[model samples]
Target: MSKLFTSYDLSGVMLSNRVVMAPMTRTRTPSNTANELTALYYAQRASAGLLITEGLPISEEGRGYLYTPGLYTDEHTHAWKEVTDAVHAKGGKIFAQLWHVGRMSHVSIQPGNQSPVSSGEVPATNTTVYAWTEDGKEGPVLPSVPRALRTDEVQRVTQDFVSSARRAIEAGFDGVELMAANAFVFDQFLSSSLNTRDDQYGGSIANRQRFMLETIDALAEAIGGERVGVRISPFGRLYDLQAFDGEEETWASVASALNERTLAYVHLNYQPTITAAEVPAGFGAAFRKAYRGTLIGAGGFTRELAEAELEKGDLDLFAFGTSYISNPDLVERMKNGWPLAEPDRSTFYGVIGAKGYTDYPVFDAGNESLKTVA
Candidate 1:
């Protein structure tokens, strides 16, 4: 039988198991800080070897989604420290995901309802942002035309990532993952279709990859490369996905560009996008040689499939998103091959605390009232 409960060492930090809690946006935090109840929420899921937080804004202007956490302020740092302290009490490791929306966010989230600042004020082609409505879960309104960022401003954004990462470490997080994936600000610069700049930050693939790689380097300098991870969705089709399929040329270029830095790990978010025909192939065996660190394959993988992929020696870690959402004891389930409880679709994003969050029960191993069988 396969040992799903095997412990793995990631840059001197040993995970209790292969399971890692993928970041899911929960808009329940009031004042944009993780509270005591939020501590309980993460502590309850401490059974997983590691946990990565929902997207955390790097600056006030970087906040795209409402109610998501931020690490820019001192108050926010202390609040996150409380949550991390709780996880430490249970011997679990957690990392915060640094994020920015670029053009995918509205001005409401920004300072003056101005379009989100980006590499170029280029409006995202076919993307809408999800803002918190009074009713909850409704508005994905068309955002304002973002103002293009000046060369100096682009450099500032990259530096901002480093500052936010330092704050995350101060807040007691073990590490931080750069939110380079998805249709956020990093994506804005990465996607050739979105960035039409004539400057150093645009034009060819090398120019497009400049901002992302620089940001990663900045974060690595702030926090050691061993403690820094980069998440990228090679063929992500979010927010005006015209360059969705670079075919082999695009993805290979992406991997080659990221070749300089010794990343802690590179996460490939494979999802069925509108751009390509093949289900977005994550960094499988092909990238094992390209990247010189742990390779994590996420976005739509089942336990059986994960095990099959892991056996190939290409994938070092796996991130379970939705499956881990409903089953807080997912590691144990994989360990015993136990049946999983189906998640309630209605309650997946539910507002109620402990309802769909922590109500799931664990296995009954043996009777406590055992006879003297010595």
Candidate 2:
């Protein structure tokens, strides 16, 4: 059985344990840039085996919500450096998540308030991205129909991922993970249901995986493959986009390609962002067969269930989400089986700083100040 505290070697960086803080979206950044409060939040959660920063927009167009921080400009890099330095000072390993929302964004958050990008001209269905208007009310709105990215422009967008990776590296992140999942830009190109374009980037399953494959190569080029990992919600659903059964054959092809490059690890987020129905039967088992490198599984997993799953040899690591939301000392809680504090749903989406973002209590520390959950 794989214990949570035992050290593991991932991408040549020796980790003290296997507990990784999954990439979550938090609006705690200062004025759309990382600041001291954000640094304190993350530095407080530095005990996690590994840390991944919240989803940071690679470009202004990637803003899926209001007040969400980004990694585009020099100021962004400088701001994030404080976070990385703080995390490292606490003896933690951290990775930044590179994000691009594509059609999953509202026009109000974009530069000049223009339409977002998507693989096709159609708009996202059955989904809504939240944003705060001038009056500061959180409202969910449908994204405008995105202009299909031209062949030449596609490289520029991919460059955004590359540039973000470089910025993350420069910001003192030990590594970086590409947000290739969750119906984002990479997700748009990977799903057969979301991408209907007939260009070289679409059509067959191999073609569907092309953009992700190319993005991985581009990111690896920016940062070494050993320091790069990609997150995929292969069976997750949002915006009426879902990949199942043979539709995930692209994952197999892409995983194989990614494995050949010897990237750090591949993260699979297996839960539906909204409904419980997104857990495809036998999906994790199939992914274990396809991926040759380290695999991290994320979803609603309990310690007992995670132990059983790990015993099956399907996942090398388990990413606990909601459980860690208000439990900054999650690893310690796991070690002692402590009861977890409930996360407040009211403040989860685009609120402000230190409310739900940093109010989590660490059990072992005996009511230590509200801390960040990696």
Candidate 3:
């Protein structure tokens, strides 16, 4: 029997299977609020053992892209409740992916037209954020220059995460995953090339890592560690994150430190095809040896590759991303060896009224035909 189809205990939460739906930014919420469409989209694909929501900004300042929802404020909480309720109705478990886009922002999106904050004053050259252009149209534009965060301001960001975690639980999420990957706030601090601060949060590897660890600790204290998961990309080069000194040691230290905790799981975003930074050979085996807790490996995983890794004990859960977009019944189709429909690349994002979001048909095993579900 394949472990991919077996049940597993994620801390106290029981997952129906080992198949996870990886977080993909759909840019469907123009109002920055989860709505009936969002709820319906998730509900349609609830068969995955776990569904990680797209990056939910903790505050307006944390937002980098347009249409991605926020998780702070009472209104945001209320909006998300609909999504959680819908997912739960179908026996699906979901985790909110908390996000802060650090230096990846523009003046049009930032509150008060202030510069985006980061570990240092450096800017993400040649990088673009999906924000409003000068012509009042939503499109990609160059990110604004960023200012270095003060030491006290750094602690305040951790508090922001704690507050968001509380709201996630209030909004009925089973758990929350910290968005520490893809050159975000935490990733910016982790990169020595980007973070030049002299405070307790920069320079050496340990100092650079302090910001993320502190935020994780604060979140764990607020909402039991078992309800918290973190996503990281080792040697990731997305959004101009350059290879820094002690990169390998930094990831190893992170794995070792996380191993000491009793958290829900540590999700590794292993996308060699997406990022310019190629993971060193055998890094997965090394990381597995370092972190003994429940591990999830996402990015570019086919059913065969996922099963191979699961059988070898390299990963506990496998997250499928693109396949889940066109095939809502992904787990069932994979289990039955059914063919998958390709997703429309153009409709991958935008508030286009579900032309590609929720209109994807599910395979009808009863009659061998595809049937559309509202």
Instruction: Say which prediction, candidate 2 or candidate 3, comes out ahead on TM-score.
Output: 3
Alpha carbon lDDT at 360, candidate 1: 53
Once fitted onto the true fold, the runs of candidate 3 whose alpha carbons sit more than 4 angstroms away are: none
TM-scores for all predictions: 0.90, 0.92, 0.98
For each of the candidates, the C-alpha root-mean-square deviation to the true structure, in angstroms, is: 4.3, 2.7, 1.0
Candidate 1 Cα deviation (angstroms), residue 84:
0.9
> Where is model 3 poorest over a 10-residue stretch in terms of lDDT?
270-279
Clashes of 2: 0
In the range 7-56, model 3's lDDT, one tens digit per residue, is 99999899999999999999998889998999999999888999999999
Q: Model 1: residues >4 Å from true position, as ranges?
A: 1-3, 125-127, 132-138, 244-247, 271-283, 350-352, 363-374
What is the clash tally of candidate 1? 3
TM-score of 1: 0.90
Q: Mind giving the per-residue lDDT tens digits that candidate 2 earns over 223-310?
A: 8999998898766665666554465566667767776776888998875556434555787787778677889888877777777876
Residue 72, candidate 1: Cα error in Å is: 0.7
| lDDT-based ranking | 3, 2, 1
